[model samples]
Target: MSDGKTIILNRIREALRENPAPRPHASHTSSDQEETPRDHTPREWLPKVGERLDEQIDLFARQSEGLKTEFHRCGTMEDARAILSVLVAEGAWKKIATHTTPDTSALLEKNRAEILKTDTGYQIDDLESCDAGITGCECLVAQTGAILVSAPSAGGRALSVLPPHHIIIARTSQMVPDLTAALELAKERYGNKFPSFLSFITGPSRTGDIERILVLGAHGPKRLTVLLLED
Candidate 1:
């Protein structure tokens, strides 16, 4: 398993050995040239310097695995549907609570066959009782392998909090480089008017408070599966 740093170094080495590419010449600037230090509004506190969409996606998936979560890559919405079907079957997750979101509404219309026993009008009680809950995410933070979710997008936090198994479907476009970037995007999208509730899920809920032994799903879902679409 190659990490991003390893991959980047390898590419640099290969380019140096094979192409011997020349460095770009620096541009001349006026003596009085000045640049704005930062945006008027406070920017997100990003630890990582730059945005690398492809690399970020790879990192997100790898990091998710490190957190004991399953990550699947899909080429399209239909591909996502196929993967979802296989996961549902494998887990034997009946009585699923499917929330209504623009993203999921389209998925359900196109691939309802993959879903089993979904409660369209999902109730808080249904979320607690359902075998699994299927929903969309607000964003995925690659740096920390956390899923950024909000009440508006998830139709309430109960679907993600109460289900024994939580399934999330998101497109590549929703991938954020880091927590800072995710926050910036969310703020821009919502301004001072943010979602009523916001939550970050690193993986299935667990706690090590019991004798310092880490236990998975002690407080939340036992399984967390993410269907990442690569459109």
Candidate 2:
């Protein structure tokens, strides 16, 4: 492919060697506010960016392999709590569990759901009894539909990996532009105290490793809901 492209470039250069094209002379043609043709208007590329974001979301959905996804926009703590209630109610997640963490307890109320606080570990047996695993996230990227989880709140990598459903509570402000921005945010937030685990979850866990057939919940949750709390 490289050789073919190089040969094509060489031929084009040779063909244009004698009849050199005239380059446009620089001139102060117009002011910064000059009226331009509507068709030639500087591209409203924000729409294209939006389209790309939609495409990424669709790809994540397809790769999710049937893993359910929902986005909740909460403007206040009350709204966030309400969204949490709805998730718990809709999923019928009666036995909610998580590793003991201040953020876990702060985000969840024991009155709303059964909070079974466990030690920091990811044993399959314990996760088997869990209906949902609610944990805190370090950061999220809007560009790629990815979430970063790290630190003592991670509850071992397996807690986020083994459950049938996982609910991640992240502040809306935590979401950045892309993976690069997320990494920069991590660096600023954690300097040298970076957590032991950092997992970037775009969607739910899925695998097409079997006969080229995609399967969801093969090793992790079949559903992943991210609640972006504004408060």
Q: Which candidate comes out best when scored by lDDT?
A: 1
lDDT of each: 0.76, 0.67
Per-residue lDDT of model 1, residues 1-231, tens digit only:
999999999998887886766754435443543533342233343345236788888888778889998888877777777776776677676567777776677656644333433334554564576777778888998887899988777757687878788889898899987777788888998999998899989999898998999899997998898988875
Off by over 4 Å in 1: 1-50, 109-122
lDDT, candidate 1, equals 0.76
TM-score for predicted model 2 compared with the true structure: 0.63
Write candidate 2's Cα lDDT for 91-191 as tens digits.
78777777766546666853466666656444467667888887778776665567788755556676776668888876755655556667888889889
Error of 2 at 145 (Å): 0.2
Model 2 steric clash pairs: none
Task: Tell me how many residue pairs clash in candidate 2.
Answer: 0
Please give the distance, in angstroms, between residue 77's alpha carbon in candidate 2 and its true position after superposition: 2.9
